[model samples]
Target chain A: MMATKKRTVEVELSTSGIDSQGRPTRVPLVVDEQGRPVPMEPTLTLEPDMKDEHMLINIGPQHPATHGVLRLVLELDGETVVRCVPHIGYLHCGFEKIGEYRQYNQIIPWTDREDYLNSIGNNVAFALGAERLFGIEITERCKVLRVIAMELSRIISHLVWAGTTSIDIGAFTPFLWMFQERENVYNLLEGWVGARLTTTATRVGGMAADIPAGWTDGLSNFLRTFPRTLDEVDRILTRNAIWVGRTVGLGVMTAEEATNHGLSGAMIRASGVDYDVRKDFPYLDYETYDFDVPVGTAGDVYDRYLVRLEEMRQSVRILEQALARLPDGPVNIDDPRVILPPKSKAMSGIESMIHHFKLVMEGPRPPVGECYVAVESPKGEKGYYMVSDGTSKPVRWRIRPPSFVNLSAIPRMVEGHLLADVIAINASIDIVMGEIDR
Target chain B: MTNFSAAPVGSRAPRDVVPASPRDVPRLGGPQNPSADALREQFGDVVPRVDVCWGETTVLIDATRVLDVVRWLHDDEGQSYDYLVDITAVEYRDMERPIEMVWHLRSLPYRRFLRLKAEMQKDQPLVVSSIWPVYKGADWLERECWDMFGIRFEGHPDLRRILMWEDYKEGFPLRKDFPLRGRFSRSEQLSQALAANPEARYSMEELSIVDAFQDLPADVRERLAGGEQPGE
Candidate 1:
């Protein structure tokens, strides 16, 4: 076949280069047969100069990426965040104010709602603090059981954090995998505590009930199988190029800054400060368990991810040790003031019936004193500061919520990063607005 | 190679120092923390009372010298309480009793926990020096304390309400006199919420950052400057 003659038109380049927004202002156009350049489909209009002008944007009091009712007002210079102002309290129920009215045991349910992901952990923590105020030592079995509950709570919290964080960074597979493992853990919690999310499984001196018969088999199965899911997630995300690109250099807080800002849990440990409440200040025999506290050097979002992942492994190790050392004894203390008599005894003996009635009607009272007991919660150093005026109800009850304090440092972390990076940094902090607003 | 798994250089906690749970801790008057003695030696009369409860030491300092004591504790090489665990205030049920401000400080290296408290009389202005200068973490803590207990931290950069909206009119919710149900009736609370402008969710400082409210009329600006109160 004969080749047709090739026809080519020489087109001139655009006049101006780029606009303020870095978009090309004009493009080359083809000419008509008369060598007259055809008017380009009306030249692209240049965007107004936005160089020196700043923009204000609000994220959410209801947006999903915020994790809960956390609103952030950000001022942007171009695409970079100049300043960030976080507005919380949409979920505020005045947990502390209500605690002053209810008895110690009644306050356990309130703790569940604050950091709902770690409800069982908060129960253990509140019970520990109240027991301290009442000046009572829990049974040895109770201590070991509380340790198991705390470790399990930590696993649940870290899984949720990882799952939601993965979703935030545009990865769906890890979220599903992580949450499947979380559901398994939740099932274990349900078997033990009878509730999934709000497990008020503790009393002032003991748990609500001892572990049901053969419950250890379920826990042992979880301990054996949960890490395989974690390993799968690590394989999917740990070395992912996109994940590393989005998180490696974002929201860096040096050790000094992290410590000064009161950032805790995986946040500070990611910054290279080896200050774990479990190791630095021991409680509930956390020191007795043999497990490593994961520390990271970068202090960035990726480091936080790595730290939390390692923490889950460490939690698994602690759970294994706790399972091996599980003892046989009453979970509640022997003291009659706090523990109720047997139902048969109360029905038969008149004195036992009166004691039961008085104990039920009037709550146990602590002496005139105050105590602040802090625990290594999944979020960080969760403390409960309580004061007694020799009354059935506490004079004052305060929750030193770690998420609240950790979230407070968001403005600093998100200041210089891009607008999209604010979400990554916020997710890395692992804030539960319930705790912050409470 | 961003040191993802690498440990920190010169980490705060040493491997040799192993912490154990406190067993058989006395109900009252246990052994005192070393920092307590050091604080007494450093500022003899400023620290008037030291009490031990549940193996935790509480050192009461004069209200005026809190900043001084905290700065010393932070800067002094010997007593490096670099981490501020928490800052909260407690009001006793007895109306006559003074309110107490509690500061929980931890020295990561020394493995010490000390509680510093300052008491303010009910009649007093309830002003205490802010520790934000020493620890930046004190920013929201002091703000929350003021928001809840109505105790002012004199020099916090942004001393506004944290857990509550800025223009909340009901008295401090955590005060002993504040009712459990709240100061206002349910109907009143509902009306207030309905009347409140959703646009005012952004505080003046935030709005002023971009001058977004500059286009509003003078009366609105005056009202906003007057503190964004509805039905004024």
Candidate 2:
């Protein structure tokens, strides 16, 4: 049997306006011979002093190398970038506006979506900020678990950064190897929190749950094997001729310039600024933990790589200490007003059930005050500034997203450099659009 | 094991009571907190309040002299707040001046953090001098404040929307009066766009399913459109 043919429609073109001399006076309803609409040419006006060699190009909002929806408008003079303007907000989710309507404890899951890579760190930052306003100190066990989760998330984040940055610099082998380690870390985290990425593993006053069985063994096993893989990847990319040549002196920013531009984390440390919020501000009992803050002398892409590599090692050190000192007690605080009652108690006792109902129905009311808590996230200093109005919901929940601030310094870093170097510089900064546009 | 009975109910645990480790303690104090004291001493009339919370100092200065005070804080010898950590704003709907701009600054050498606050009227032309000249980091931060809160930053090199698109004509999203779902105009525009595209029949539905259906063979596509299984 023969198949039926599809119908086609044809539209006529209107070429009505013409001069009496059979010559077109003005172009009216211009169309190609095939009846396709033809667009008019755009007019261009240039000054006499303007050079013809200068050209403008847009880099993203859809380009692969932009990391996310980040767009950059580049003015190029030959192969060098004359000026670069970053246009962001393609991923804006109105996190702050949405957060204002959410209760204190309910905001944890939302915080995870902000910086999806370091969701654990973002959760801890938000919880700590809210806890400060509530004037509630978490238990030692909770603090230790938070440190472990945060350091693991840091390791995972830095691994992704190293892997992606190496890929950006034309090394694919390291990317594969680094992701292997990241997968192991994710497996370990999945065992603990049931979710790998965007893990809302923390609560306002404590962790969502105690560490699962054999989770530590998995962490230790991964930690033992991670360093060997890290060193292998390091040997592959750290001193490779192409990697070194591509990243050694590219995107150099001085310590002064870094600080003036609000750069933090490895971005500032690579510029020889000895600042780490874990050491300087010391939330979650980080003051007692023993680890060295890695400092870099040059603020180039290579220095940032070295700084981040050393930072992952430092995170391992912190993780080991936290695991060893992990206390044996309740993860949540004893306060019934803040934490939910145990299920056994809630099911059996009236007071416990009532407390659970009240805590779940109306979240803990913090005093009317404001506090800003920053954590040394892998990208930079991720902070949460919250203002309370003696209610369950916050009056203002402002996220001090480090990627948003770090991405701002791109134009300064890319100016006067080859266009190819922009990718390396952007990768070295390691910005996540989720956080930047939150 | 540490004693839990002696501790007051809901009080902080004695976590820091452990003997200090032999690690070198970095000097965290600088010139007796110079930012608050020196600014109060110098700009006494302009500086209204100095609050110390959780070991971080916040100085509330007059709205007009915010740039001058930040510049002074940046250049002063004792209080060299060379780093601009964050810039944000809070809105109070019931207050006389509803919008308050907050600046978080830090001195790297001293490891001290200082917050500077200035209030502005809620109406249009909410102008405050830009601190871009003092710290280049304020460029995007000021633009973000302008974009989200509709506060204008005077003298900003490029004071445009940082988070929202240029074509977004709806009112600021972060304002107190703005609805959480979205402004009505945005939904109207969305419906208008949907109405304008007749060929986009499956655009509002599950887009992944539409994409998969588009990839199928023509007969299969027709079968799916007719609500029939691929293999009966």
Candidate 3:
């Protein structure tokens, strides 16, 4: 018997609306040469049995779907993924190695490049860790300002995640909408720090600059209009059939597994674990800010999406509270060791000039101690572990990159899922390769 | 199966658990984490040095019993340090100082954070028990620690180079002795980069996956055979 067979399928055409002649505007029926209706059937070809064989496929170090220099070698039996081995470090510049050579304040710029999406947040986190190492408590005004910076950066990161994930799942309109809101946040950041992407806005003891005069007005404007865009994207994607069908029930990790895998931020929270670092290990006075951490029961791709969307709204609430409780005081601590003198004072007074010169040249030294300060970054728990040797430079400055840890579970998440679902699952992880390979 | 709805929320600190903000925390020692005391009681000899710095407790334990202490910390109901935050090695500036391996663990249920350290002297082989048995997240963290610091974590499955390529020969980049510039000179590094074969990107684990090597073109297969042998 032949391996292939032919079959005929019937075509049914619907009638179009009536024409000017009042007749149904229907297309002419498909007919054969013998004056009979043609059965338009496609041929089906059968091949030899090959269930035992598995195919190996490679994705990126260049592909966009893998998201920035992430190479995945996947083992597949037909369409189902049997195994996945992720190769990274294509963008690794050894930021940790470089951190050892730079001064504490000088290292803030390096933090900006590691997680480019959450650059300000990383700067804030490094400042917090370095401040702890130095035993310096920042002023109340600086605290509130850092909180605003963090939440704004969080919104920027989640917006990029939402936009990129939507595009990955074949929804284009929401990507544009999400990116528009992200641009608004970036504009606000640019107004504050004068840089859009790499806003190294934090110093060791305080901000690089206080939110410029009337800057809270821009933030107020953002807080006012951001939710409208959030709601628009939510309305489009939350119940859209295609979005739900593609995202839901993929990359399911239970609470125990998520916690054991060291997942954090939205990744662990989506697994129904309400362990927000801001709440559990409260820093920047996050406990005083009244906001609910949205927890999800399913712990799948859909839950992660919902958790992230809700987090942006919660960030808005926190930003509003931070703005309301914005204290009026000095931004930097009243210490000459970590903070520099005013530019005019440095040029005018000898004592101020000596202080500024010493600080700028030698760099403020921290006592011999180590502090691991973790903040709940948009992706996960971004931490800066610092070790001081009573010297201007750090003995070791380790960035506990959350994306690296979250991406580690890709092999576990993608195995046993279909090849198409792998893209959705990887997108759900929301990895920044710069952070992962740093 | 875990109850999906009634999953364990945050920590078991209290019904109204509120973590202290950084501003309120003392500059130096205030209160030691209770787990530090508990670890001493559980493993007296292994838990040698316990210190509190910047309000966070650091417990220095013997490198040999790291896995045991970590497993007990994870399994024990009272001191449930369920989350492994990070694994890193710190080589101090002083050449004579022993390299310290740090493990940052967090107890989500109890809202407690603890640091565990194990020092490996330069004379001894940098070997320590892996905590992968206690936490699956330790897999990549251990591999990365090995990659950067050259600390070999015993019993770790697939503890290979993570941030660097498999055949990277520049020595551990994070080690104090390693120069700021890489081991190879600039021209030599550029020449090596230019001479690298593109086909060697795939590891033996990837190439051996179900007929991949056999499927390669004969000339490519000959090239690979002439190069560094797979599984070397």
**Clashing residue pairs in candidate 2, if any?**
none
Q: Across all candidates, what is each one's fraction of true contacts kept?
A: 0.58, 0.33, 0.54
Please give the ranking of all candidate structures by lDDT, highest first, separated by commas: 3, 1, 2
Regions of model 2 farther than 4 Å from truth: A1-51, B1-34, B93-97, B185-187, B192-232
Q: Write the per-residue lDDT of candidate 1 for residues B1-232, one digit (tens) a residue.
A: 1323333332445568678987887778979999999999999999999999888999999999999999999999998999998999989878898999999999887888899999999998999999999999999999999999999998889999988888888889999899988888999989988998977775566566456556545655666777865442
Cα distance off (Å), candidate 1, residue A219 = 1.0
Worst ten-residue run, lDDT, model 2 chain A?
Answer: A1-10
Interface RMSD of 3: 6.6
- Residue A226, model 3: lDDT of 91
Query: Model 3 Cα displacement at A18 (Å)?
Result: 26
Write candidate 3's Cα lDDT for B44-94 as tens digits: 999998988899999999988898999999999999899999999999999
The local distance difference test score of each candidate is 0.87, 0.80, 0.87
Evaluate candidate 2 and give its CAPRI docking class based on DockQ.
incorrect
C-alpha TM-scores of all predictions: 0.89, 0.82, 0.90
Error of 2 at A229 (Å): 0.5
Q: Is the docking of candidate 3 incorrect, acceptable, medium or high quality?
A: acceptable
lDDT agreement of model 1 with the native:
0.87
